[model samples]
Target: AENARLRAREAGSLAELEAMVAAFDGCALKRTAKQLAFADGNPEADIMLVGEAPGAEEDRAGRPFVGRAGQLLDRMLASIGLDRSRVYIANVVPWRPPGNRTPTPQEVAICLPFTLRQIELCAPRFLVTLGAPATQTLLGLKEGIKRTRGRWVEYPGLVRPARALPMLHPAYLLRQPIDKRLAWRDLRLLRRALDEEPPR
Candidate 1:
């Protein structure tokens, strides 16, 4: 009964939600962005991946995860029997921050709710936060992604009850190839979680 209600709330059809988000004008990043790179992928997938903010490539392409870092993410998902086509992907801040610096708290504040609503819209079984900012925002923790990645944590306060698996972002991976191995391990962990069935 509870599960059925949850599905109803997160039912397919992000049209209304997307429309609402498109009209949002709180975040300052929106002022300087080319376009709102809302989200890209299967809306009903079991996994939702969230990044921090759009970079040059994302701003120009109007899509998250399209640059070199995104390429690495594509390859990572493919390595684990998954791809963007089968998962939900988006950023906390849809627009690129000027100079590509970390978003200010106020910027994240306005946009975080948008992404949260997005999670409600996508309704993924699990959330894979893709960087320090993403992880910290979702989990409300001050710990670094290194201290938190690859572990499953229940998020009851979120719109949907879901598990979170924080991981190093692909952008970071490009900066540190040796860290790619760590991301690979997190992917394996995600695969294992996906293979499990909910307890009845």
Candidate 2:
């Protein structure tokens, strides 16, 4: 954990951070994973969306959100007049845990510094955490996504704070199609916020 903090703190830019995460072997997930599933989308975007971890397709593609869930996410973003070109996307755990298993707490702990640093470097106006793990991890929220989704919270950014919104993960929504209505409401909230933010 100490090593992660030190390495993450040393990253001067997003490129530097990616390089550091690629080289750092602190997390065991790195060993089993094929490659780093870093971030995708415009780094200069006003909105940044973060998910729990990479899935098989994302891991293989070395990019965040590239599978069925990713396709759904893209559609969700489009529903609000946003897309990959307009927003940044990343995952809490860059590597795909073997068989897509949930990352252990220790793994999340070690990798969190890098995730936090990624957000700091991006410095987006809005931080959207998808699913329970990301919302809980980034926002320090204790409640589940069902309870926290759509509510605005403050993200304690290292550079500057951003308005954080928790939302249901696309994968979860895929399993429970009816819950997409909730996601739609959250999307509307985000669109409203974006419309109100005035051009950067």
Candidate 3:
């Protein structure tokens, strides 16, 4: 964990961070994963969305959110007048755990510094944490997504604080289409928040 922190601290820019993550070997997931599933979208975007980890398609593509779930996420963003061009997206764990298994606590601990650093560098105004794992990890909430979703919390960013909104993951919504209504409500909330901002 100390090594991971030191390595993450060395990155002064997103490019450097990506390079560091690519070369980092402290986490065992790096050994089994094919490539680093780094972030995608405009770095200067006002909103940043984070998910749990890379899936098979994301791993194969070396980009976060490229599978069916990703497609759904894209549509979800579009629903609120946003897209990859308007927001930044990444995952808590860059590598795909073997067989898409949940990453162990040790693995999350090892990679968390990098994730935090990534957010620091981006410094978005609004942060959307998708699914329970991301919301719990980033926001330090113990409750499940059902209970925590749609509420706004402050993310203690290293650079500037961002208003974080926890929401159901697109994958979960896929499994439970009826729950999409809840997701729609959250989307409307995000849209309202975005609209509330005064013109820059």
The estimated TM-scores of all candidates read 0.89, 0.98, 0.97
For model 1, give the 10-residue run with minimal summed lDDT. 1-10
- Model 2 misses residue 131 by how many Å? 0.6
**Best by the lDDT measure:** 2
Please identify model 1 stretches exceeding 4 Å from their true place: 1-13, 158-160, 198-200
Considering lDDT, which of the candidate structures 1 and 3 is the better prediction for this target? 3
Per-residue alpha-carbon lDDT of model 3 for 1-200, expressed as tens digits? 88888889889999999999998889899888889999999998989999988989999999999999999999999988888999999998999999999888788888999998899898888999999888888999889999999988989874667899999999999999999999999999999988998534
Judged by TM-score relative to the true structure, which candidate is superior, 1 or 3? 3
Q: Write the per-residue lDDT of candidate 2 for residues 17-115, one digit (tens) a residue.
A: 999999999999999999999999999999999998898999899999999999999999999888899999999999999999988878888999999
Candidate 2: where is the Cα deviation over 4 Å? none
Q: In terms of lDDT, which candidate is stronger, 2 or 3?
A: 2
Angstrom error of the Cα, residue 134, model 2: value is: 0.7
Ranking the candidates on TM-score from highest down gives 2, 3, 1
lDDT of each: 0.81, 0.93, 0.91
Instruction: Identify the superior model by TM-score, candidate 2 or candidate 3.
Output: 2
